[model samples]
Target chain A: MSRRARAGVESRIDAPAGDGAPGGSGPGWPPWACRLAGVAIVVHLSALLAGVMGVAPASPLERAAMEWFGPYHAFFDLGYSYRFYIEPPPTPVAVATLHFDDGRPDETVRLPAREIRGPRMRHQRELALAHSLFVDARQAKEQTGDISQSRLARSYADRICQIRPGCEMVVWRVVQHLIPDRDQVRDALDSPGAGRFDLFDDSLFATPEWIGDFPCHGR
Target chain B: MPRPLIEIRRYLAELSVSTRAGWNRFFFAPADPTALGLIRAAVGLLAFWSLLVMGLDLDAYLGSGGWESAELAWSSLRPFAWSFWFLVGDAWLRPAWIGCLVVLLFFTLGIFSRTTSVLSWMIVVSTVRRAPAALFGFDQIVSMLLLYLAATGASGQAFALDRYWRRWREAKRTIRAIPARYRKDGLGRAVEPDTPGLPAATVSANLALRLIQIHLVMIYAIAGLAKLQGVSWWNGEAVWRMMATGEFVMFDFTPLARWPMALSALTHGSLALELVYPALIWPRLTRPIMLTGVACLHVGIAVVNPGLSEFALVMIAANLAFVPGLYVRRLAIAHEQPAVRVLFDGACPRCRGWMALLTAADPCHVLAAVDLTAVDVRTVHPALTEAGCLKAMHAVTASGRVTAGFDALRAILLRLPLFWPVALLGYFPGVAWAGRIGYNRYAASRPRDVPCTDSVCGIHSRTSPPAARDRSRSHAPNNATAIQEDS
Candidate 1:
């Protein structure tokens, strides 16, 4: 026979039976196909069950309904609502107490107090947002004593203007040249009148001693 | 007399019966006992190698994302579908693994042989699909063959585990009950031999084979024609330029660049050889020469460009299909001839002078001069005339046939080891025609000092009328001069 004709016959003979059959003849379908189909069904069903369980409700009436028919049902409803607010303390106090060793040169600068407002006050507002606030080296030491803690807190309200264009000592760093006497600074901070001012604690700032100390606490 | 004849008749009857039985066992048996064994061995080896290459951690390769990773694994199922089932069962693994496994099983077990074939085909298809960049020509060819095999029920008969099970079932049925059609005395009957015709399964396998064969021929013909379509191929510089590229150069040809002109000519010649290759297979006269030329080209490619070795091997293998069995026998016959022999027109001064130079150059002393003028022209070659010899060079063999001009040159080169290089020149584009024209010119311009003495020259003189001979003689010298100038 011609090769093409023979090939045609061979192709027909080789073709798998049930290729066109729907639901295929049972005997011809291998057992594995059925097994795979079963596995797929199980996986899909379990995923569906998990999805239903995740969206179920948790109130008394809803819980009761869920308990009775939770397996069959996909969702449950519950009802309630709540509200409230918190207020800031009045006359917030902020002490400025200077702690320096004996015979150390005191570097302090004093200026008339000023009010800061409007969009320009954002810098001070951002500074206040941080737990530890800093001030220029001159002003920190000058205002260290005899400053009411509550009035010191008001200084923050317009303190941003002190750093603005019209303000004196706009940019500064506290540079205390102190002798090495840790006990003296501790005694000054513990004194009864120390609460009146904001403290210029050089030990709290990053310094050689602070680095040696490793961890420091501020009050 | 009755006793001797009777014994002889009995002996002859027994011999005939035994011979018939032997034929039945060897050629017409219902089952190929070794077929299953071969299938199993092939499948097992394929599987073992695949698994070993995979290192039993098929996940990594399958996850790497391409068909090559799972090719060995999938090929194991090329005979049946058992591997495909195993793959489907492990669906949570990477799809490549699953796909490969599915293909393997389908190929192994021959279950829903066609469907599994298709499924395995799809898996292989997906592999090629997912990473076409990694696909090699061999991989594509294998995939195509696999799909064709799957569609054609390659494992339909004795070459499968399915067939074994079928045989086992049939054996069981035979043992359990004696069918009324075959039972004679309420006793179990021997099983009947299968009818003599093409088995459905065999038919399927043959179909796949036929498709492969057809595809192979088309690839060759198309590839050859495509090469011919290019000018570089016609000019013979295609090979040189192709090899000059960095990607193809595994070995440096830098020193050879000074002779780029020669290299370019060789390239153009090679391309032309390839272009006309398909045509050469058609004519019996050219088949051997063309096939040899193709083989040499492939061998050259394999040596110079190892990266193309696979292509060369496949093309060489495919070329074998064009070679008829008779040609192979002819080659075997040709090999018995002597290494070198000189053929010349003894009557022609120019031809004899060239032959003398060729003979003197034979350091190995292998040359044997054969004069066409001295031989019995009719007895030597019934197909050729004496006039034919006068027109061109002729080489006669023991079984004589006039090999003229280019063909004579080819035959001489075929016998000589050193001059084989010149035979390769015949494969060059347009060289054969040029050689023919050159030879005719040389033959026509024979010097007057060489006189014709016999009927051989008489035939040439008679064949051409006086006026035509005069005109040819006048123009022949100019043609010879032109040929020499062109060369």
Candidate 2:
């Protein structure tokens, strides 16, 4: 390890190697773009995770961020799954009975369950999401205050209007729960003016007026 | 700057260089074409099928007066920055939708590949924004796959017309280049580019594959983490409930519903798979087994759930990244003559440059190399000589013939199966004579740094065990002592 040998090595490198291609790390100073992309992707992943966690009592900033980026959550949350009545056997869940201006008063009207369960291509996916929003809000309402459920119900009304075309106004949004209890379900269906054998709407839990188009959709 | 601050600055600079090197190794390295090409064809067709399924209810879902009207969709998605429906009116919507359908067909067929790929992705984004309710995990997965595919231009490298078109042109050009002697024999005209498994590796393809791999891991991790929070997942009753559900119920599973133990086992098993998938899919040894397990799980979902076939297929397509192209190539070309090993002085700057150039040029990768200057050279080849190795390039053939200097390099080039026409051109009467003189003169022109010490050798610090050294130093062209079959 003499000075002479080290100098020789340096001199050899200094001499033109005649290699045509550029030195290693081709493309000078492009790491900025990569760093930017890297940061953006990380932020996106974090926002999606936050959405899936559905953080309650979130800070004002967190809520605002979620509201803005929440729609993008669908792509990231593909792994987030929610299947209906998966355990303890299938149970009947209540649906919002759609009563239109054309329908008679005091007559039973319900969400189209048949269309929701129809053949593959013919099956309208809109009913599924509408029903999901309805059930989710109602379930949340059981633990939280009435405010959360009311907001969700309003959103559902708008969504349903968008799905059911020419449905200018809704007569009522009151719906009764369908319990799994055989005796209770039978009583509700067999009652004088019952809606369906499995599920029927009651006037006990009447949500507020949902007469016009959603604010976003503009009547 | 103060002394301490200057030292800290130097340390930070070194760290930056190291980090950049690591990033390049992980993300910017070239990827083999086999897996990239396979993924493109399989995933592209699956995406096309998904588009078709969405098309069946296109008007009902995305039309102006349909269930999910354009106006309503736009309003609902106003928070988002962009939507294709915002650009086109009802009159233009049908044509746009039809254009997407046509573009997707071209994407699957790999026509105007890069252009069609971008168009296909645009269509996917439009569909997602317009009919958000109609989408499932399947749609999301196809879009994600297409996103990665669009980033890579070589997606159509295999099972594609693009490959054949390029091959035909290359063949025609190569035949024209051959000297009249070989041309008259018709050997040059009969030749074709053997690009099947030997896809030229590309940085873009490699980066896209790495992204897909990381994304897949994240998805599984999140899925498993999410399931762990659910109450039904704890008792395995959730599995039964999915089968017994209303709209999702494709088959009667009342019998499984009766067996609490079986259902619980399945539910827990599902959770376990999702959690462990990310961990097991990294190592080369376990990657295959992990992907097979994934395939089975997806297939089970597809079979039990009638409408989820597309989802299952696309997921399996994503797993294609884990399949090793090199392993597949070796398996496909088994029993061929083992590649000869070349030994060179990696410490020499010129030699290092030669290694880099030769590494890229050898498409079929016929020659293997080792650094003669490495300390472990003695361990790898007990009989390898220091002086002879430093003197010139040396390649030991599989049949154990020692070819020296320029011929050592030529031996490697000559071994390429597909580009033998080009090789023959180099080996021709006049070209061979000129090439030898040029290579010998280049070798002789180097300064004789005879008192070569440990400090002079660049690879002096790099001491590796035989197996590890062989794998890493296989890129280093070797010297006179040892020649083993390329691993």
Whole-model Cα lDDT of every candidate shown, in order: 0.40, 0.56
Per-residue lDDT, model 1, residue B309, is: 55
Please list all clashing residue pairs in model 2, or write none if there are none: A86-B241, A86-B242, A176-A202, B342-B478, B343-B477, B343-B478, B343-B479, B344-B477, B344-B478, B384-B481
Model 1 lDDT, residue A199, Cα? 25
- Give the Å shift of residue B248 in candidate 2: 1.0
**Chain B TM-score for candidate 1:** 0.36
Candidate 1 residue-wise lDDT, A1-219, digit = tens: 986996465444332211121111222223464345345434433433332233323356545543444332211111100000011111111222222233333322221111223221121222222212122212334666422222222232223322232332212221222221223434554677654212223442233110001001121
RMSD of 1: 35.8
- The backbone clash count of each candidate, in order, is 39, 10
Per residue, candidate 2 scores C-alpha lDDT tens digits across B162-252 of: 6545655554454333223132112211233333324555556666677678778777876787666677788565666555444444565
For residues B1-487, could you state the per-residue lDDT of candidate 1 as single tens digits?
Answer: 7999999999999889765544322222122112222332234233323323332333322332221223333442222232222343224445546445655664655555555555655555544433222333433444544544555455444234454345434443442332222222211112211221112323233334334443443444545554554565555445554444332335654344445477666676565575576455544457568778888887777666554454455455444434432232233234444343334554344554555334422322344565544443465457766567666766766555457777787777655433556878887889888988886665666542223444445433323346754654444333222322433
* Model 2 chain B: ten consecutive residues of lowest lDDT: B478-487
Per-residue lDDT for A66-176 in model 2, tens only?
Answer: 666665654432223322122333322324434445454422224325443433533325333445444545565676745244444454455556566555443324232
